[model samples]
Target: MLVNSYGLNGMGIEAIKLFDKMPRELIFEETYVCVLNACSHSGLVDHARSIFFNIINKTEKIYTTMVDCLSRAFLFEEAQILINNFELHHSPSPTMLMSLLSGARNKKDNHLSEKIYIRIEEKFPKHKNRLVSASILLSNAHASVGDIEKSLNIKNKLYQLGLKKKIGLSFTEINGQIFKFRAHDRSHPRSKDIYAENDKISNELIEHGHQFDSAWITRLLDEDETIASVLSGHSERLAIAWNFVANPNTKQIQITKNLRICGDCHQVTKLIAAIRQCEIIVRDANRIHHFYTNGQCSCQDYF
Candidate 1:
């Protein structure tokens, strides 16, 4: 709880300091998980690598965590080397591949993603979930960097395989009620108001010189001119919009996401926090990001 809380606040150094002081016998696998995570968010590459290589008889999960730490720090080559050296006791792990691919995605390195996929294919050729999911990842990475043709072809192949990309979801709670949302969602009873308020927020952001980029959006929807419309419908935005609609008295708003928070949304959240004079906390798959009303985020934009 302590390490996670520090990480959640984007205080990686504090988390690291606390974890490092514990005796070796008292430190368990889970402790390293948190420590590595803290290091990743803090961009402590040297510290993370040290922890990675120093762990005794590291388990696969620990190896994966260290990979994530390196990936988050943009140490792609080192991360791949670590993965390659691991003596696998079973079939290749899809999550590790996905993590590496995410690192590639950050750098928009399509070739690297393809190479990683080829490696996965060689080892686990028949793993349905692994292949399809990785194909989708490769598609997104290419598309994000404006290689629409490659992305579309991968999507078409996914269609041939009858695998659909899982819809990303984000959730929030208000007035003791839980709300679920998706992209372009209109099923909510107050969707009309929600969408309207979302537009209002978007207009505000644009007026402040906020420029949306394709890197933070899905390559699928980002190719079109309707990018603004698409961005307005992001689940996290909708959740925050709902809070504005009904919970104006709240000083801080916290949201939880099932997937990684896109860069576009992250930027928008920062602008929103400043404009509205409120603090927001977002817990996405990668790490927790805190948006302060002063146009600052806890993750320091590293995540």
Candidate 2:
């Protein structure tokens, strides 16, 4: 009715009003979830907090939803407080805890990260999955602070648990064309063309005072250069290659990946963005990492 009577733009506010008009008994778990979602959509922190508190007497699911909303809003401290105060424990859902850790990492609050790690271990002793998840979080935090050895050790522990890091892949649509690639994938029909273009662009970058660091390049290249050639086959690279072939004059490419991007790929993407003078938006497992020509990334090399 709101959409038909007013417009789609007014539907949300009208829906909230209608929800307000409904008796308290009519509001349930789903209602609380919807309200929290609305708060997320509209950036209504105060309204979200009020509705979140109201649902506290309801269910753990509601608490989880509230925690998710607060975390999405980057209110990690508040989210932590909610979890701490309510003492809500629904095992196996490491999202809230992960969010808290990520928030601390973003803030460079290493002390808090250590404390949270201990708290998580103590509070959820039965959930062994937290070990891997927490380790990954700690690895990320360590990497952000240039503690490479510590980060690699954490990653190694996960690998020891038989949990290998999945390669990141992404596909982008440009001018009605879809391009795709996986890490070290060489199966694409246009593989040769992609390599040729990468070579050309890399040369131009070097000529323009962009020094390719041995550390970054060494990771991509193998003993036979075969492995290095495979790096171009990465999903992001594949998408970029496709974008290059599909669009003749486009300036930007957007790719979304399902996993946390590896260190090597992150470095390469930044260089690619700089050399091409194109905006590359990469949405990874954690957050969006936007690469640009000024040798910078949106995550500030934090992820």
- The model with the greatest TM-score is 1
Span of ten consecutive residues with least summed lDDT in model 2: 212-221
After aligning candidate 2 to the native by TM-score, how far in Å is the CA of 67 from where it should be? Answer: 2.1
Give the Å error, residue 185, model 2. Answer: 4.1
Model 2 C-alpha lDDT per residue in residues 156-263, reported as the tens digit of each score: 777787877565678777777665677656677877777676666556645656543322221223477643454445577667766766664567888888877755
Cα lDDT, all candidates:
0.81, 0.66
What is the clash count for each candidate, in the order shown? 0, 2
Give the number of the best model, judged by lDDT: 1
What's the lDDT for residue 122 in model 2?
77
Over 49-82, each residue of candidate 1 has an lDDT whose tens digit, in order, gives 8887888878888888888878776788988887
User: Model 2 misses residue 299 by how many Å?
Assistant: 19
Q: Name the runs in model 2 displaced over 4 angstroms.
A: 1-15, 88-93, 124-130, 169-180, 184-189, 195-234, 243-303
Q: What lDDT would candidate 1 get against the real structure?
A: 0.81
